[model samples]
Target: MTLTINTDVIRRLRDALLAEAATGAGAQDAHPHRDAALARVAPFAETMYLVMIADGRSAPQEIAAVRGAVRLLTRDLLEDADLDRLLDACAAAASERGAEVMLQVLGGRLCANRGDRETAFTLAAAVALADDEVTDSERALVGDVAEWYGVSSKRARELLGAMQSTG
Candidate 1:
C-alpha cells in the first residue's frame, strides 16, 4: 500500500477550522452580556403578560406593557420585528405550558439575580396596573410573583405604589 500526503488538502482543512473558530468567537464577542440579560428578562415579561390572561382576558394595555418592558429591557439588542417575534414565542409558550410552568420559569429566572427579581416585580406590577386597575385575579397573580421573587408583601406594595404613582 502506498500513502499519499497532499499539503494543499491539509492547508485547506486547517484554514476551514480556523475560520469556523474565528466566526464563533466574533459572535460571542459582539454582544456578550446582551443575550444573557435578554434571557433573564424574557421569562418575567411572559409571566407578566400571562398574569393578565389569568382572568381569561388580556387587555390591550396589559399587552402593551409587556411590549414596552421587553423593549426597554432589550433596547438596541432587538429590533421591532425581533421583539414582536420573541414576545409571540413567549406568549405561545405560556399558553401551551400553563400557569404553573410559567411561574416556575419566572421564579427560577428571577431568583438567579436579586436585582433582576426586583426589576421584574416592578415590571409585573406595571403590567398589572396598566388598565388603571388591578383585578382580584391580577392582584393574586402579582402576589404570587412577588412571593416567588422573594419580595416581601410590604415591599411589593411599595414597589407597586411607586410604579403606579409614577405612571
Candidate 2:
C-alpha cells in the first residue's frame, strides 16, 4: 500500500485548531484570574525575548533555552507555537515602539511586587547566559531589566547567585 498525504485536510484542521485557540483566548477578560496570570506571564516572557536579542541577534540555542524556561515557568500552558507567536508579537512591538519603550511597558506589568520584580530580573539574567557566554551587550540589557523592575543591586546579586548555583 502506498501512503497518501492530503494537504487540504491538514490545512483545514490547522485552521480549525487555530480558531478554537483564538476563541478560548478571546474569553480571557471574562476570567480575571487567567487574565491576571497572563498579564504577569506576558512581561516575563517578553523580557526573555528582549534579552535573547540583546546582542543584536538571537541564537537558536538562546531561543530554545528561553522557550524551555517559559514552558517550565508556566507549567507548559504555552505551547511552542504560542511561544513563537509571543516572540513575534514582542519583535513587532519592539520595532514599532522601540526596545526601550517595550521594556518600559513590560516592566510595568510585573505585578508591582518585589518578588515578581526579582524573579523577572533573575530569569532575564539567566536568559542572558543562555548561550553559555554572556556578551557585554546582553549583560547590560540584563542590568537594565533589573533596574527597570526596581530590583535592588543586592537582591539582583542574590538572585544571580542562586541562578548560578542551580544552573
For residues 89-151, write the lDDT of model 2, one tens digit per residue: 878877788668877877787737878777777667666655566777777787778777887
Best candidate, lDDT = 2
Candidate 1 per-residue lDDT, tens place, 33-114, comes to 6567567567766776777686778877666666666655654454455556667877798779987777777788778787
Give lDDT: candidate 1, residue 141: 72
